[model samples]
Target: MKIPKIIHQIWSGIDGPLPQEFRSLGETWKRDYPDWEYRLWDNKKMVEFVKNEYPEYWFVYQKYPFNVQRWDAIRYLILEKIGGMYVDFDYESLQPMCEILENKTCCFSLEKEVGSNLFKVFNNAMMMSTPNHPFMQKIVKFVFSRTTLIPQYTNKNLTIFNTTGPYALIRLYETLTTEEKEDVYLIPAQFVSPFTGLEAEEVRLGVVNQKLDDCLDNAYAVHYYVSNWVKTNN
Candidate 1:
């Protein structure tokens, strides 16, 4: 089945107004993929989504150390239930995702590691799936199983990556059976993400980045790395 032409992005606004800078970035997605359905989510809608559609995860969702963690988890749940592309608000589109996602049942982008703290090869920032795909199903189960802190838990400092983000996805992905793995595509950087975190920041700060300008020449999408996750949570 082809990935549906629905796009999902979330901004908590819990932090106040959605930043002015990201508005133009979001416009790129709309411009590149015409006629696709877009769903923008906020803090309250996200909370209600879990309570209504995933009542079982209600307590776990509320107890998450940071709202960003919930942001990471809900994307998987949404994709699995309805099947669509869940792109981060910081992500910009150079072209429609239709071609890259045309043949895959589920897909993830290859992340360029820029720091020691970034511990995963894949980024959930740009993901696509068909409804009820096994890989997404597994992610839902994975998120729940590791959603809370236990005595054996590490990263007590609190990180979005390890707790419920891409690192958790990478961990579960490694255990997938050969058959299940076949249906999930790990797309290389050139197509979805080509810049390192440092480069993304450089571009955002208005520094001239010729290499990334070139990457945009080839990639269908670029994640601008507008970080919403706090390094530590209370």
Candidate 2:
């Protein structure tokens, strides 16, 4: 069955913390799929609509010390409450991601096993899942319930709450059966080129042509890792 395409976007603000990496991702949705019904979450009406329509979706404020991690928590809420495909601000798409769903409930990215602190980094940038999915529900629960006390380890580079959300989900994803995992497509490199270190010849080949221009053409979305791009332009 062909999956119905429903695209969504959220802008915190022009000078909001996400910067261009986030807006760039949103721009891709507008540019790549003109037919897509895009929605921004910052407006009061839209925020109310999402909450009223799907109360299961809950968002937390970036209060005091928690300011740094609120964005991640907001994403968790949207994915669970709205229950469709959602992308983070940093994610960029090279093609129509809707074609990949085939109507399946959820999709997400997988970073090759990388460990930082206890939290493993999974591709939370682009996630597709339904509210009814058991696995996804479990993840939403885990994220919401956890208390994110800053870690005491100052020498360490990573923190638990910072990466724990994505890491836990990725770890869980790894354990799924082949058939189970198939329900969630692992969007190949060509489609979701995460701007991680690219020392490998193959990765360079895939993304190196005409570089930014080529990226703009093929990418339905691009996860801009750099914040300056957004701050300077928008």
Which 10 successive residues of model 1 have the least lDDT summed? 149-158
lDDT at residue 104 of model 1 (Cα atoms): 88
Q: Write the per-residue lDDT of candidate 2 for residues 62-99, one digit (tens) a residue.
A: 22133224445555566665565566555555667555
Q: Candidate 1 on 163-218: residue-level lDDT in tens?
A: 67777788888898888888889987778887888888888888875676776667
TM-score for each model = 0.89, 0.64
The true-versus-predicted C-alpha distance at residue 175 of model 2, in Å, is 4.9
Off by over 4 Å in 2: 1-4, 14-25, 43-64, 111-121, 150-157, 160-164, 175-179, 194-221, 227-234
- Model 1 RMSD in angstroms: 2.8
**lDDT of each model, Cα atoms only?**
0.79, 0.53
